[model samples]
Target: MDSSDREVRDVNNILFGGFTELFCLFLFLVSAFFPNSLLAGDLVEQWTGKHTRIAWVQDQGNGLDTYGRSPDLMLYGYDSQDGRGARPLLTQKSNFFKPLITP
Candidate 1:
């Protein structure tokens, strides 16, 4: 109504808008770092006797097309990086680790 009241309202609106924008940006940033906790199904049984780590990367769309639907690349190797009888084992892509995994 009055000039003073209008000025105060405008300032309040500006502050609110800025806060909303900041909160949204913060949430976006947080989500970028969040892990994709969802997996298609249980591969635990298939993982028997194999020592591996499953890395779930959250898609921040940072210029790389991480083929999300593609099968996970399983890298099998010795338990130790460099030690006695420690060596990186390579497997064929098609019949992969059939000899290693199977007894």
Candidate 2:
């Protein structure tokens, strides 16, 4: 019916939607509020559990890790790139929807 009835229905809709939105926001922001929580750790737990290792690499500020036990026990992230890092070129000027350049 009337204008007052429509306004009350709209207010009910907003109140219900506001509570749902607040719940979703709480779920999204719980991690930021509590930095030490493990909410998504299970997503990677299986892979990390299978490949994780517990070893000590001796570091004495000499620019080298002394995992000198065996050659197969080499460390990672130390392979140099000759000072020029990875530079990827984007070959696609546009996607299926829109062009990347406006001009």
Candidate 3:
């Protein structure tokens, strides 16, 4: 084929690839924004194992250093039956504050 024909084919290929990528990205974003409508009882039960309550705690700063603040902590617990007692399953500490070291 001639040089001009090859150039046109290349341009068309690039445009088609870009459009496909953009369409996939748009679909993902739309799905993420929509509320979850499916029932997740089985999944929740399998993960949490029976009756469980997740607790999250936010440590309020003393108002001394407004820039550097600690993140909130998350805790998971499981309690079964009447007055069975609560058991802590997992605990995690997150860092939502500004990092001390520069990237």
C-alpha lDDT of all candidate models, in order? 0.34, 0.33, 0.39
Which residue runs does candidate 1 get wrong by more than 4 Å? 1-12, 36-103
TM-score of each: 0.22, 0.20, 0.22
- Which numbered prediction scores highest in lDDT against the true structure? 3
lDDT of 1 by residue, 1-103 (tens): 5797688668867867686456335433433443221111112213333332222223233424233322333333322112212122443222222222223
lDDT of 2 by residue, 1-103 (tens): 6797688668857866586456334433542443333432222234334322121222223434222322222222110112211112232222222112211
Name the candidate that leads on TM-score. Answer: 1
Clashing pairs in 1: none
Residue pairs of candidate 2 with colliding backbone atoms? none
Candidate 3's C-alpha runs over 4 A off are 1-15, 35-103
Q: Cα deviation in Å at residue 30, candidate 1?
A: 0.2
lDDT-wise, the better of 1 and 2 is 1
Model 1 TM-score on a 0 to 1 scale = 0.22
Q: What is the per-residue lDDT of model 3 for residues 10-36, given as tens digits with 9 covering 90 to 100?
A: 886786767645633543343344323
lDDT of 3 at 98: 36
TM for candidate 3 is 0.22
Stretches of model 2 off by over 4 angstroms after superposition: 1-15, 35-103
